[model samples]
Target: MTTILVTGGTGTLGRLVTERLRADGHEVRVLSRRAQPYAVDLREGGAGLDAALEGVETVVHCASTQRGGDEQAAQNLIAAARRTGVAHLVYISIVGVDRVPLPYYRSKFAVERLIEESGLGWTVLRATQFHDLLVTLFQGLGKAPVMPLPAGVSDQPVEVAEVADRLNELALAAPAGRVTDMAGPEVRSLDSLARAYLRTTGRRRPVLNVPLFGKTYGAFRAGGHLAPDQAVGKVTFEEHLAHRFGR
Candidate 1:
């Protein structure tokens, strides 16, 4: 059995990926700074990482910091993988990171470059924003009487479980550089999504479509984050909401 080490294994997507790999009968070890069984800090390069990657054939890198420092973490993972002679390093990245001007998106793009140049066999899968992320955003915004949404911004929110399944498949296959982008089945405006959330969760809030200015909004307005041509995920945001709320 191929021994695989999954970083951020306790996270949203990481947890699903770990479960999928284990269900497939692969020897899986989860890496987390706080969790047990495999406690290794990606930020601190030392014996912990070395021990984690000792017999690991593949490393599914799902760990990321939206607050920054993701590039450094990726570098640390790459160096450790090289030292351990890991056969494959699978990385999960956000869609349109190259085009999105947000700092978090830029950090993800930088990690993509690092993985590409790391010389280690690697496969990078860029997926659209997850449904859970959108729901959380709307839930936070829905607290107010009026929810503000960026105008002309559309999202193709894919399911995290689907992305996790794809990551599992990629981990088993030979490294293929960057695979096709993954997106949700349908694309909807941000305002519409927010309104849907409000209706589903019984929150009565007026969604205000505010015109957003800046490169980040420009990229989103231009549909840079969308992969209509590569809409491989079958789950729609509405279906996800329905399942979540039991509607």
Candidate 2:
């Protein structure tokens, strides 16, 4: 059995991947800011990182910062992996990072470049938006009687559970450089999805279509953020809603 070290093991995707790996009989070591199995803080470098990664052959690098100091943090993690002589490193990335001109996405792109040039065994999987995005969209829309859908925006969101399963499989396989993109089984328009979601949750709300401004919005509207052709996810939006609201 390979001893796998998982960074960000307590997070949404990380947690699931860790559980799956452990259940599959791989010896799992989780890196976290706090002590559980192993303690590591990629942001603030120290002996902790070195100790946690020592003797681990494969690493699942799920640690990410959506804001503040993400680049430096990712670099630190990479440096630690290099120093420890890790055999393989797998990074989770979003599909739209190259097309979208968002700050956070730019950081992810930068990290991918770093991993490529590091001369280490590496694999990157670019995943689409998660089913959890429905909750974020709902929160953004609030309780308005008529919610404005960003006109022309489309999505091929995946379930986090499916993403986790793929990550575990990657952890066990030989590094393939970069894997095929993963996305949900359905192609969905933002407006229709939102309306369906609200209805399923027993909410009565009308949707209004409106064009949105900015390059990020434009990129999304042009279907730059979706991966429709590579629909590998098993969960549907309705199933996701039912899981979330316990319907």
Candidate 3:
């Protein structure tokens, strides 16, 4: 059995990856900020990481700081992976990191470059936003009677479990640089998504379309984060909501 270590193993996507890997009979070690069974903060480099990487053959990197500093954390992880002689480094990134001008996306793109030039076997998988994220966003906005959504913005939110399954597959295979992008089964406008969410949750909210003027919204409106050609996910947003809330 190949030993695998998953960074951010307690996170939403990371937790699913860890569970799938463990269920597949791989010896899985989870690295998290909390003091869990095999905890190691990627921001700090030390013996904890050394122990976490001990005899590990592959690492599925799912840890990320949504606020900032993702590049530094990735750098620390890369250094430790090199020291431990890891066989494969699998990184999960957003779909529009290169095209989007957001700070978080820029940080992810920088980390991708670092991994590509790290001289170690690596594979990067860029995926669309998760259904859970969309749900959370709609839930927050649904609290108001009139919800304002970004006009001309659309999303293809894939299921996290699908992304986790793909990560598991990539972890077991030989390193392949920049795999095909993953996306949800359908492309829906943010307005429609909000309406659907309201309908599903039994909320009566009028979605108001507000024009978003910014570089980030521009990229989103331009479909920078969309992979229409790579819509490989099978689950629909309605199905996801049904599963999530038993609607």
Per-residue lDDT of model 3, residues 132-166, tens digit only: 99999988887887998999999999999999999
Off by over 4 Å in 1: none
How many residue pairs clash (N, CA or C atoms closer than 3 angstroms) in each of the candidate models, in the order given? Answer: 0, 0, 0
Task: Candidate 1: give the clashing pairs.
Answer: none
How well does each candidate superpose onto the true structure, as a TM-score?
0.98, 0.94, 0.98
Model 2 clashes, total count: 0
Model 1 TM-score is 0.98
Poorest lDDT segment (10 consecutive residues) of candidate 3 = 35-44
Q: What Cα-based lDDT does every candidate model obtain?
A: 0.91, 0.86, 0.92
| lDDT for residue 178 in candidate 1, whole number 0-100 | 92
Write the residue-wise lDDT of candidate 1 on 1-247 in tens digits: 8999999999999999999999999999999998886787788768888888998999999998877778878888899899999999999998999988999988899999999999999999999999999999998888888998888899999999999999999999999999999999988899888888888888889889999799898999999899999888999888899999999
Cα lDDT tens digits for candidate 2, 113-216: 98888778999999998989776877679478788788888788799999999999999998889889998999888887897788778887778889779989
Q: Worst 10-residue stretch by lDDT in candidate 2?
A: 32-41
Q: In candidate 2, residue 203 scores what lDDT?
A: 81
lDDT assessment of candidate 2: 0.86
- Over 4 Å off in model 2, which ranges? 35-37, 143-146
Give the top-scoring candidate (lDDT). 3
